[model samples]
Target: MPRGKQTDTKLTLVSQFFYPDTSANANVLSELAVGLEERGFDVSVVTGQPAYAPNDRRDDQPRREMYKGVAVRRIFSTRFDKNESTVKRMANDVVFFLSAFLHLLFKRDEMGVLLLPTAPPFLPILGWMLSRVRGYEYVPVVLDLYPDMAVELDYLSEDGVVYRVWDQLNKRAYQAASLTVTIGETMEETLTEKYGPCETAVVHNWEDGSVIQPKEKANNEFSRKHDLVDPTTILYSGNHGMHHDLESVVEAAATLEDSREEDLQFQFIGEGGRKVTLVRMTKDRDLDSVSFLPYQPVEQLPESLTSGDIALVSMQEGVEGLCVSSKFYTAIASGQAILAIANEETEIARIVEEVNCGIRVDPKRPGQIVSAIEHWLDNPDEMRAMGERARSVFEERYEKEEAIDRYATVLRRVTT
Candidate 1:
């Protein structure tokens, strides 16, 4: 832990998002950088200006700053609107890619290891290209599988030339990495099948128990503000993006409109492309039991998360292995029972079963979803037990300290 020895163990984390940004990726990378810095490793982050806020930017912010003993260098990139057109988004990605490439190229000697996540989806390729000559250990963290996600979402055809080219690049990136890190075993399995065997680690994303813990709704600000006091709240809080199957939840609400108890409610907090559709469906079906709320600030996350009786975690049909919901960990830490609307065989479902934290209902089955919620409502004791078990398992396995240490260990192993 000497200063001189620490200088030789420098780590450079490259991502499009970082602290002061509200994105989940930003939070994850920020925590990792700070944790690594505390462990006596010289850590620096190469990121872009604050741009994740929809249609906003801090144009006057400085390009460089020191945050909590970690060196943060923000690159100059196009400050396009966060919800811009596809061409504009790609341009933004290109600008960051070029700017980050230059920074890493010049500072390659000092960076003993590079941790790059697939934010822009071009970063792994950039690192793979540089590692050929730079000789720095490249560790690619697979947050979401590219090209496959696009194809699954119908943005690109699997048989198209673009898909084929991107798939090949993705393969090369995984192949070049000294160690590939993904959040769940399902994602790791998908990567293995797609690119053949590679050195990979399945480190689940974690939550800070102190930051997001159980709180009584009567004392919770979010619950009181939103009048979420009486109902047994079924909360879906996070990005309602294309990767999630929120329609099933809406259908479940409509199905139980008359049969559900008067005190039962479904709350959707957050915004994305699918949110509009969800809102329309609720109104068109005259589902009075449903309520929509904008995403709460991070400071309010604890109260908002704990306001729910059961937290809903969902994934679209084909998106099982492509991405894991980070909200799942936070929901567990919130001490709420989990109702996962995904494949029963998925990693999230497996965790729910192993911990006895909640139930799994396939998103394609609205009846099953309704039944699961109703069953939980009928058995309050079982629900309370599940919530208790959720917090216990979270502290034992998904706490921030342990997960970050595991990540540090993986980086150390690959570099040494």
Candidate 2:
């Protein structure tokens, strides 16, 4: 790994968040940086200060630091500000795009390869702009598709100026990049169909030494302390945004409020834009069956996950092809059964149905969710079998070791 060797190639990874950000994209890019470095690439990451996870925060740290032998350069960003409005978040993305675009321009000539794992959706444009400089091969590792996804989540209008501009830029960026990578096969297929087979690839995200499956204590301190002594626990952790329409879960909870399913509780863990309204609705209805827990630390993930009998992984009605909740992978690794809330045709639903991995309910239907929960509770053998199936699916497709090996190979092949 000597510097300036004939075979030595410097690769730069750009993202909005890095190591300390607990989001899926941040975790994926951090691992990619470390993985590529180990594979003998001169890996350098350019990211904004972490606004979400403390570990990803870089505002107080120096502009640059060596992270696990990878050189990480933090670009200035305003996302670190607390309680950002929707407008503020959009503005933050704009600022990061400009700052990151400038940084890439400055280093364009030095990098043999440039990788951006979904941070600012504007990155494809920035990457294309930087690739205009000689000697830079822009590699876009897409964690999620924008415009389409944003529209699905109601973040942007389908025909809005922003969407129209981004759509064109994204297509051009896809055409311009040396390779475009995604987190799973479904996304690979989706991107392939959309852009007509540019060098797109799949590399799922993984957990590192920083995170451990939380030990599922028979009694989670949060559950016990909060007196959530339900007969069955269905836990959903991560952002509770519009993307996570809790209406179905709420409706199911209401339907089962008078039922004797003592352990059947729905616990939501994590913060998001819709949290306030969601919580208010829950409180208004006196839904004691539902409880909210603040997201726990990585060290406590195993225990946090163990708090529930079942794990809930869901998405908005659409964007099924474009995004898979990385949280579902974590639940699988935790060896928990999943009650997937998504479209029937999605890879997630396919895995759940094909493997019988817990439950698959149209998240739009509370009655269906209630029935699924009741069925699982009434048939413990069936439920436990689904848990086993979920774990098998993880070992077969989403295991970190396998995913990282694929990524390592991609880094080499694209650069070679």
Candidate 3:
């Protein structure tokens, strides 16, 4: 059946990253564009070249192509190593923003409803500016709240001039948007509280259960290749950014090592600014049970995700509503019980508690993390049941098709 009424409105998705970029933001937007296209909307994506993967630069990829029935336009931008330096990353974002603005400006007549994701944190401001000039509707999808996130990370002071200006700009853009979308209730609350009451919708981030469902470790090739078959593995399989509480996780592992938990293993996958520090910490602690690996290919996600018995999801103590981890949905979809290290106010903690699918620990308490792991270790059957429940909840509430449909509904309401 058709997902929604076929519409003539041209939907353009704007972001710094998109297809061929392995970042969670890129992957989600790519899927959304294709899903909208499949639902009978004319969809186009304007994104920069692949820069998320350090070794995978796609400067040679065609500037324009029809990818999975969605028109994709790759804009020219600096492909800096984002993990290496903050300045270089900002340079890349600035160039992408300028280039995207120019590209969209020239195509103003073709623009209908602009779907903006906060990749560079200020991308929604561009959408707002374009909407004002072209009299077109734009929906700002709040992936990560800016200025506030920067403030929490200590990248910007709350009282700084830059923070004040950015926060004011954010308020203006969100208030002017036809509809603002947030990925979780906590985020929606934060948005409305900060900007005052405005049109907003909470659509949780999701994963394709059909693609990332449970698989036996013995039968999984990636698991076997990585030697993840034997131990009760705890996996942290996403960006190790500054916003995440990875140090607590490492400390928990160290504590577990001290307890002589020989049957437990900690695996860290994917790379980010904090990965180097994490690797050094593991080595300095002589954590033989801990392992670090680069991100696996997309095709191997099913195997890689199911390789672990527990999935570690975390965030820094104070940045609860600023962003939600996409890895949480993927973990549930892969039928892995979550070991969430976050504040009680976070969406992850709320869901874990509501569904009884996993355990939540305070990010500030490494001992709580260790205790949670120990609980799972002691009650293996209960842990397996939790994993099963996680997958069930994912299928019912957070599947990829369901999220895309909600997005379609939002787009329809905004455009009409």
Candidate 4:
């Protein structure tokens, strides 16, 4: 690299995943890499092989490549079929954390700015080990506090040995970070309670407008191929896993069954641990009002979402405030109304209410979900108002321009 204006700050974004993967960590980190580079930072990335997105497992490919302007080093990791066994997934996490730590250990001699965020929650352990051995500038981004939130959500048991170990790693990662940034107010608050507000700051999420736009027609020949449509379409696109516990969604569909008077249709498009079970629940109950499909690329989101009259964002029981779904920003930017099903007290619930862009149904109450969806579908005028509100919220809070600027400012703050 030449000695440019950014020569003073040869920053490297470190994670176990990057772009070409549709996960939120990949999308956010990719944007951060490009944005920081544009803001006069000599940027590169140190990551693992493409362990996710567009691929079911860790791909057998070259160890390194460049995407656009970012220099990337893809280290080796245990093969992980994201769609496969839970044991394999855990093993992948262990390997990814160790490999990333080793990669950073070698980089520490010349490290400038190291940006480490979550994918495998223990990446911070790598950040800590690398920084302590050879002190380097680091900005720890906490997407979620492992074992803390996960344990709270019951994704991991409170007293599990792994959770206990991760709880220590979580504290150490925070203790070592020069500055910390989080994606939601709830997370910011949580960090404050632990680390105090001095070093941590709230940089709530924003949209990647580059890949998202108003695709008037979904253009999904698959929808046509399947012949699925109705009076109104309410689509939920993202993880359909255990944490999502989509039973209430199915129950809502069943509750609305007798009313057959309303033609509202629920479309679930994504993959997860709970998907098969969700499908079975919907099947055994014979709920004809809902449909399911596989995940798609981020680029296809606008088309997929705008194809419907409304978009849906839901949190499973006991999972509220654990994390914010990146899809909320996408759905908002799509200029579509969102029916957010979440606890009435969480950050997501606050967003839906503040945006006034859609209804907020008690996610635990299947009956309430049914009633809210019905009322929204039954009123076109209100729906249009909700869409406009949705767009307004996106422009004010979630647009790419705004988000990039926020990140750039934070980069300068932590690096300088």
Q: How many clashes (backbone atoms < 3 Å, residues ≥3 apart in a chain or on different chains) does model 4 have? A: 0
- For each candidate, the alpha-carbon lDDT, in order, equals 0.84, 0.75, 0.87, 0.72
Instruction: Give the Å shift of residue 217 in candidate 3.
Output: 1.2
RMSD of 4: 2.8
Candidate 2 segments whose C-alpha is farther than 4 A from its true place:
1-6, 53-59, 80-84, 208-216, 219-230
Model 4 pairs whose backbones collide: none
Runs with alpha carbons beyond 4 Å of true place in candidate 1? 1-5, 55-60, 82-84
Between candidates 2 and 4, name the one with more favorable lDDT.
Answer: 2
**Best candidate per TM-score, number?**
3
Model 3 lDDT tens row, 54-107 = 745745568999999888888888898988887898899899999988888868
RMSD of 2: 2.9
Model 1 superposed RMSD (Cα):
2.0
Two-way TM-score contest, 1 vs 4, winner: 1
How high is each candidate's TM-score?
A: 0.95, 0.91, 0.97, 0.91
Model 1 compared with the native: what TM-score? Answer: 0.95
Residues 1-416, model 2: lDDT tens digits: 33232354678888887877877667767877787677667788888777874334444656789999988888888864333466777777889989987776766557668887667766777878776754467888787788788888777898799899888888888988888888778888888787775887777776542244433444567556555544577888887766776777887887898776465678888877767777887898898888887767766665676666788888778887777787778777666788888888776788778887878888688888888888887887887777777677777877666677787677777776
Model 3: lowest-lDDT 10 consecutive positions: 1-10
- Any runs in candidate 3 off by more than 4 Å, and if so which? 3-7
